[model samples]
Target chain A: MYKQNITKTPKAAALAICAFLALVTAACLLCLWHTGRSSGQLTAEVYLDGELLWRIPLDQVETPYTLEVPGPQGCCNRIEVRPGSIGVVWADCPDKLCVKQGFIDRPVLPIACLPNRLVIRLCPAKDSSASHAAPDAVTY
Target chain B: METKKLTFLALCATLSLALYAAESALPPLAPIPGFKLGLSNIVTLLLLRRYRPRDAALVLAVRILLSALLFGQPLSLLYSLAGGLASFAAMCLSGSILQKKLPLLIGAMGGLAHNGGQLLTALAVTATPGVLAYLPFLLPAGILTGMFTGLCAWLADRYLPRGPSS
Candidate 1:
C-alpha cells in the first residue's frame, strides 16, 4: 500500500504544509489583533454557567477581595480580585487550571474553570446606565 | 480481526495510555488552560500510517475511555471525546490524501482540530463567548505540539520493526 501511493511529490507536500501553516498563523494573528486591542476602561465579569454573576470595574478597585463561586455538584472556585487584576486563587476542581492561570488585567484572554463551570473575562466598561440597564448584554 | 493483529493493537493502546498518563502527571505546559503537549497522539499517528484507520480509531477510543476513567472528571471525558474524535478524523483525512509522508503536516492538522473541538465544547458547556479569546493562544500551541508528536511518530515508524500488515 505504501509503495502504491508514493504519487505526491516532496515539493508539493512541502508547499501544502507551508500553506497550512501560513493560513493558521494568519488566523492566529487576526484573533490576537482583535482580542489584544484595549479600550479606555476595563471591567472584569465573572460568569457561572452562562449567567453574569458579577461585574467589577477593574480600574476602580481600591482594595483586594476574594469571591467564592459555587457551581453544580459542589464545585467551587475562589477568585482573587486586586486593584487592577483578577485571578482564581483556589478551586475545588481536580485540575487547578484556573488558579495556575494567575491574574489578568487586560481584556485579552479569559480565565476558565471547566470543572467548576466558571469563567472570568475582561471587557470594556460602558456607562453606568447602559451597564446597569442590560447586565446580560456584555459581549464575552 | 486476527489474534496477532488484535494483540498488537492492544499493545499500542496500552503504550498510548501510558503516554497520556505520563504527560498529565507533568506540570501544565503553559498558564493557559487547555494547553497540552498531546504526546499520546504519536501512537495514533503511527497507527494511521502503518495500519487501517479503523485500527487507529479503536486504539484511540480505548485510550480516551480508559484514561478518563482512571484520571479525569466526567466533564473532562466530554472534552477528550470531542477532541479525540476530531483529531482522529483530521488525521485520517490528511493521511489518506498525503500518504505516509509528511506526518508533520497531518499531525499539525490533528492538533488544530483537537483544540478547536475542545474550545467548542467549552463554549457550549460554559455558555460564554469570552472563552473564544483563548483561540489565538491555542492555535499556535496546537500547531507546535502537533508537529512535535508527528515528528516522534515519523521517527518511530521509520525505525520500528515492521509488524504484520493490516
Candidate 2:
C-alpha cells in the first residue's frame, strides 16, 4: 500500500515543507519584533471574557497594588500591578499559566489564563497619541 | 475490526495516554501558557504510519477522552479535543501524500495545526484578541516540538514489529 502511493520526489516535498514553515516562522518573528517595540506611556489593560474590566495607566500608578478579577464559574485571577509592569500573581485555574507568566513591562505579549478567561496586556496609553502610533494599528 | 487489530489499537491508546500523563508531569519547557512538547503525538504518528488514519483517529480520541477524565479539568477537555482533532487531521493528510517516508515533516505540520486549533479555541473562549500575540511564539515552538515527536515516531516505526493493518 505504501509503495504504490509513494511520492515521486520525497526530497522536493521535504524542501517545500521546510521552506513553507521557515516563511511562517519569519513572519511570526517580524510580528514579534514589531509588537515588542514600545515607547512613551504604557497602560495595562485587564480583560475578562473580552470585556474591558480595568484600564490602568502604568505611569500614573505610584503605589503597586493587586486587583482580583472575577471569572467564569466563580473563579478569579489576582493581578499584581506595579508602576511599570503587570502580572497575574494568583489564579484559581488548574494550570495557573497566567500566574506562571510572571510580570510584563512591555507590550510584546499578553498574560492569559485560559481556564479563567482572563487576559492582562500592556500597550501604549490611549491618551498619548505619539507613542500609540504603530503597535495597536497593526493587527495579526 | 478484527479482534487482533482492535486489541493493538487499544494498546496504542493506552501508550499515548501514558505518554500524555508523563509529559504533563514535567516542568513546562517555556513560561508560555498552553505550550507543550506533545510527546503523545509520537504514538499518533506511529499509528498513522503503520495502520490507517481511522485507526489512528480512534486511538487519539480514546487518549484525549481518558486523559481529560483523569488529569485535566472540564475546560481543558475543550482545548484537548480541538488540538487533538487538528493534529490528527494534519498527520493524516501529510502521511497520505508523503507516505511513510517523512514522519518528521508530517509531525511538524501536526504540531503547528494542533497549536493553531488551540489558539482559535482560546480566542473564542476568552473572546480576547490580545491572545493572538502568542502566535509568534507558538509557531516556532510547534515546529521544533513537532519535529522531535515525528523523529521519535520514525524511530519507533523503524524498530517496532509490524501490526495488522485495518
Candidate 3:
C-alpha cells in the first residue's frame, strides 16, 4: 500500500518539461547554426585548452603532414593535415571520437578529445584567398 | 541491510551492468563526442521507483563501478565516474524535489548534468575553454537520449513485477 505505481505526472509538471525540452531544442538549433557558418580562412587551427597550438593552411600545403599534439597527463593526439582538409588520424583516448570524425574540409564544430582537451577547428584565415584557393593542380 | 534486500540489489546491479555492456557494444549513434543512449540507466530509474532512494543510489554505484571495471579503461573510469556521480546527484535531487512525479524530466536533467560533468572534466584536464563549444551539441543529445532512457525505465517499471519477490 505504501508504494503505488506513479504512472502519470501532473499536467502542470508535464507541460513544464515539454516547454523545457522545446527550449533546449531551440538552443541546440542555434548552436548548430553558429557552427554551420563557413570560415573565411582555410586554415585548420588546433587548440590545446583554448591555446593555439598549430595553424595549418590547407591551401598552401603541397603534402599531407601529421602533427602530434601533446595533451594533459602525457596524452597525445595525431592530427593529419592535407590540402584544404584536416582530421585526427590517431588519438590515445577512450572515446576515439576525434579520430572517428574523419576528414573535415569545411568550417564547422571542432573535433575534440575531451580527455586530452584538444580541439581542432577549421577557421577563417586573414588571407581571404587562402580560403578559396585553387585545387591542387599537381594531383591532376 | 537484510540478506534478501542485499541479494535483490545485487541482482539489479548485475542487470544494470549487462545493459551497460550492451549499450556500449552498439555502434556510436552519432559522430558527436560523448553522445550515448544511456541504456543502463533503466535499472537505476526502475530501482528508484520500486525501492527507496538509498537503494537506488547503491544500485547505481555498483553498476557504474562494476561496468567500468569490466569493460572500461582507467581514464574512462574517471570520466564516467565524474559523469555518473553528477547524473546520479541530479536524479536524486530531482526525485526528492519532484517527489518522483516525473521520472522523464529527471532523466533528461540527469543526462544533461552527466554531459556537463564530462565537459567540465575535459575542460579541466585540457585547460581548454574552447571545449565549451561542445555543449551546444552535447546538451541536446543528452536531453534526447535521456528521454529515451527515461521512457525505457517508465515502460519497464509499468510492466516489471513489483515488490521484493518480483
Best DockQ among the predictions, by candidate number: 2
Model 2: residues with Cα > 4 Å off, grouped in runs: A1-7, A38-40, A43-106, A109-140
DockQ of 1: 0.20
TM-score, each model?
A: 0.69, 0.69, 0.66
Tell me the lDDT of model 3 at A97: 91
Per-candidate Cα lDDT values, in order, are 0.83, 0.82, 0.77
lDDT for each residue of candidate 2 in B1-166, tens digit (9 for 90 to 100): 8999889999999999999988988977765776899999999999888877888889999998899899877778898999998888877877766756789999999998898888898879867676686789888888889999999998998899888766
Question: What is the per-residue lDDT of model 1 for residues A1-140, given as tens digits with 9 covering 90 to 100?
Answer: 76534655545765776698779879898777765565657888888886789989988988999999988979988899998899999998998999999998767778989888788988778743333232221110
lDDT of 1 at A21: 75
Q: Count steric clashes of candidate 2.
A: 0
| B3-104 per-residue lDDT for model 3 (tens digits) | 888898998898988988887889787656688888888888888767887898888888877876888766677778788888888877777666676688
lDDT of 1: 0.83
B118 in model 1: Cα distance from truth in Å? 1.1
Q: Score candidate 2 by lDDT.
A: 0.82
Per-prediction backbone clash count: 0, 0, 3
Q: What shift in Å separates residue B119 of candidate 1 from its native position after superposition?
A: 0.8
Candidate 3 lDDT by residue in tens digits, A61-115: 9899888988887888998888888999999898899999998877766687878
Q: Tell me the tens digit of each residue's lDDT in model 2 across A80-109.
A: 889988988888988888888899987877
DockQ for each candidate? 0.20, 0.21, 0.17
Residue-wise C-alpha lDDT for candidate 1, range B1-166, written one tens digit per residue:
9999999999999999999989988978675778899999999999999988999999999999998899887787888999999889988887776766789988998998898888898889877676676788888888888999999999999999987789
